[model samples]
Target: MRSFDSTGVMEQNISKWELDTPALCVDLDALESNLATLQQTVIRNGIASRPHAKTHKTPAIARMQLESGSVGICTAKVGEAVAMYEHGIEQILMTTINATPFKIERAMNLRRWCPGFVQATDTPGNARALSEAAQAAGLVADVVVDIDTGGHRTGITAGQPALALAQLVDQLPGLRLRGMLCYDGGAQHVRGFETRRARTLETLAPATETFDLLQRSGLNTEIFSGGGTGTYNIDHETRGLTDIQVGSYVFMDAQYLAIGGATDDDVYSDFETSLTVLTTVLNAQYEGRVTTDAGAKACTINQPWPIVKGETGMTYSSGSDEFGTLRYDDPSRTYQLGDKLEVIVSHCDPVVNLYDQMYAVRGDRVEAVWKIAARGMST
Candidate 1:
């Protein structure tokens, strides 16, 4: 392996070190376990796992998933796809719709570089825009029609409109109709397994019907893509889905754990919590309370309050923008200042996006620092 010297040049000399607290950390063992577990699950169910790279946003993790037998990766933006392509990721599915000329040009550029680029479009106009751009670039772009599977986010109605989009792809020059892309973002954290399964079936029905309609209309619906960490297993069992695009399973969060879908035994035996926010107890004030360095700025607080790992009888509370208050009902139990603590973020994706790098840790040592390459690439 190559090493860097004190002058910051690759000299094969110096040892690397870790920074301070309030940094996002990945448990190497847990992360590898998470990747292997998801890959095995998808393979066992006979589905292609194309994990969404929007979770980690790092090419290194994407490579891990790809090496673990993931068919490809999904991104929410063209810039992310370009980054992944530059990093030698050939196959990519841009999950969002790109309608404007500027974004279409970017998509075409990516297709030029990586011929395996695929995108999802919901409207005929968007499809036309992409087709025109790709035709000008002299490259064929693979396209999937996005269907609104109860998320109400960015997909078209999953019936005639979906079929129309597929037809548009078939007729449009420089565009190939690959399949359908429908995501039920609402099912990611549904409380109970039965409830999630029921909602998933309800959400997937229209999309599946649309695929069937397209097939019947002589359009080959080759790919039916959707699913997330919370509902991968359920989506895998769905009849028409040909591929799974789960992201957060690589980095389990507090919200995913709080979700009551799978039984406790099922969760424990299945996915491992691979991500955590390492914080230090900044202050020990108020007999039963302590404050940590990580708060809203370090971790995402949108879903619910975070949980302190293995700190029984202690509940986490938001102190301020930069402090997290920990409370214990037992007056006898106390946490002192400068105590290192691991916090499970309520939401993993947004929390990971907040940091610039993730420290991959093994036991007590920091092994690697992976840059969050796609962080803040919203445009």
Candidate 2:
């Protein structure tokens, strides 16, 4: 299926494009709208938008984000950074901790390949390892001290632990202590705006205070990065965040919609539901029940069940490994076999990792296809 450009005129030629059922499909119109909304919002608020690439896992989308005035991109792993760099993304911050020597060597190589490559670590040992690796490579590695705000994840707690780590990073010969990294994963899904704001401040305030302390200690705190699709607006409004690392806003999922961001309205429309699982009705068993080709394998079961778009009074239930059951109370409005349906995934990031390629669609036509190049680049 072929779609026309923004002109709306149908093309006479249709390519022989066939996508397997239960594959991921991205609506191009919705995707572009989502990107524009986030880019505009970040710029309007005077904050640098460095969207995380771990969501889309596509270099094409990353290039678009950079073109939209994003300062850089963030990845969760070294392999992801390498893949993005190979795809022409220059500045990247590996948000996760990299302590292994092999990983440090790889990071140093990446820095040599790409002019701007940064990594975060919370301990002095890892910082020293990175410094040694960079020294061996005859280059300086940009490092950020990861701070534990409230997530209790991989980061040093504020106050003594954080200060000590920052001081050590500064003392290291081949490491440049860039700034502090703190991400409140827990605040991303807080339902109420006030509640989310309160939680974000509660966590981020301490981290910001730690950054202030680092600056007071004569260390430059250049970049204070954190935030996601759920908390981008809140973090932008917050005082100390210089960069917002949002990723899922480009292809919103059902889980983010349930987060109840700044408004009580349907959050799905805030950013269009660009990512979807395209399924075909395979079984029409019973009176009011139908089965689709996509099951747990196609859609992520990480959050609550996915919602069927534009289909009211319909509930989706998992059916084994290769099928999903959709039940509707009204028997008269039943779907027949071979009918196509678009399913909204619960978590866009992980669900996107499940696919190999994403079909870009406009209306009912396919315009382009993007590869999930870094889908399994977890290392």
Candidate 3:
């Protein structure tokens, strides 16, 4: 609505820097490359890509992921799945366990309409509750047993505990046991590639054994899904890994980039940094220091503070509520009022949750504005 284009992009020839300050942006070229790179890599390695939607939380981007050969998209919240479902995104795996009375009702309501919906469970009680709700609704719910691969965030233990849960899911009325989610989320952020690889395999060893246990027990073990951006290349090395739930690869940030890449390059060069925050310098009174409009509210406070794109020796800080501190020891260039700079964010997921929409841009041109439709879908 702001500029001139039939497709809702800004006026022709308007650069991305011309956009409003503190805006979230997706560099379309880098994004497409990232998508194609990850999709091609995972597919070639005989692994399926079921990317997580909680990163961008945009249905448009989810559709892109699906088109790029992602088997489905993963969502951390039930409402995020519901939103994607409403957008006609069929292949969805609800990665979070929801057993609350109202949440169960909501999941059932969604299951009634979403044939591609698959839910995750970690505990026996939650699994039982889900089956009961599914049975009452005359629908059989599909689910994955979330095996905690050292994340300790959710899921049952490996070996006996995990196998028992899978067995229970198999026998439950109105429930179909899809497989297990052995996501080693904790290992994904390990700094060195080899170190991360070792941690992932060591963490996943028992979980893979559990997968074998499920198969030996004659239960459905079709989907042994779990992996993240940091461990995508390394995950396929493990046996029975059906898919890697790679999320942030589509729009990398400072946190992921800091983790060394496959060749141990000290920067995760496997994926490009496609997501960014566009901010304008609001004040430049102090030498070697400038204030930007992107503060904690815009960029979020996860370090190593947001990196000023293409400019080394420049540091960014979102210390203030509405202004960011740009500090430099020596001069690369002088900053002036209203000068725009793009900085890669520390974390992409929660920062995305703060924005209403993100502008997709090609070099010097706005391509589209995608709404973060599930921005605050905490449930």
Candidate 4:
């Protein structure tokens, strides 16, 4: 009954079973295997691997990925980058655009914290702002031009417009154009292997053209970084991409599983589902319905329903902000009060952001408690 404790008062070295319910758990063995596989795959393809820290948001895991041969780590925000720096991660790429005065200043300071710090830009105004801020801070901020690549997110058109932005950054005094970044987020989840591969290739065409344009304009950048777990294999085979900035491959979720692999025959099982939510059945008085403690606040609501580990004939439904309802097809299999259940999260990113710490478990024992360093670091 004492699950979901964030008081920071729990004793150290507690067994996994002894912990309270509704806890965030990471399988240490599975995590290590995922890290090793990603690094090995990237190395086999001869491309730099920079795992995105925004997914795990734990410095311990970031360090493991780096130690496993990742070129660097990618952060989604300046605050996340700061957290990584506090944990002694020296090389970081802030993969989002920062334009506001305070955010630009914070990003500039982060550059000072990590010598290899880099940020992305898609507009000339933002580029100028970054250049001015870096100049005022007495630093030359490394920058990457962000290509839209059909995501319709915060990026410029990949070909001429992206090259134009790179040119502007080059002309700016305190901004150094490191390379171009084209992350096809939608292509990463295109379901079938051939469709995902074809979509990823088509989306990156403009990025390739932009890279070539930059070279012809006498402004060849050093790196072409952008990729996700969904398009890791596709990006690895793409010639112009220098580094694959993948995040979710480390602790895959239901969404990634549904994306399937290049063969179109199986889920992208290159990595294991190392992360999970351990919930406790709080109520089971109903005939075929049970309720657990994990809700939107715990496991995130953006993804599909969480999968009940090793169980069939049951479906998890959203109940309240702090609870989930389980509907079972097998009425005979009734759950009792205080019964614990393990669920693979629907989405790993926001689910990780909801917890302050995660228990690294091996079998039934807790191996370590890793702090979520960048939980609320949205800025």
Best by lDDT: 3
Tens digits of per-residue lDDT, candidate 4, 198-245, equal 888888888888888998898956888988888787787676788898
| Segments of candidate 3 deviating more than 4 angstroms | 1-13
Candidate 2 is scored at a TM of 0.92
Runs of candidate 2 with Cα error greater than 4 angstroms are 1-18, 265-269, 331-333
Q: Please give the TM-score that candidate 1 achieves against the real structure.
A: 0.92
* TM-score versus the correct structure, for each prediction: 0.92, 0.92, 0.96, 0.95
- TM-score quality measure for candidate 3: 0.96
The candidate maximizing TM-score is 3
| Residue 44 accuracy (lDDT) in model 3 | 87
Cα-based lDDT at residue 38, candidate 3: 86
Better lDDT candidate (1, 2): 2
| Over 4 Å off, model 1 | 1-19, 265-269, 331-333
- Candidate 3, residues 21-70, lDDT tens digits: the string is 78889999999999989878887899899999999899999999888888
How does each model score on lDDT?
A: 0.82, 0.83, 0.89, 0.86
The alpha-carbon lDDT assigned to residue 23 of candidate 1 equals: 71
Q: What value of lDDT does candidate 2 attain over all alpha carbons? A: 0.83
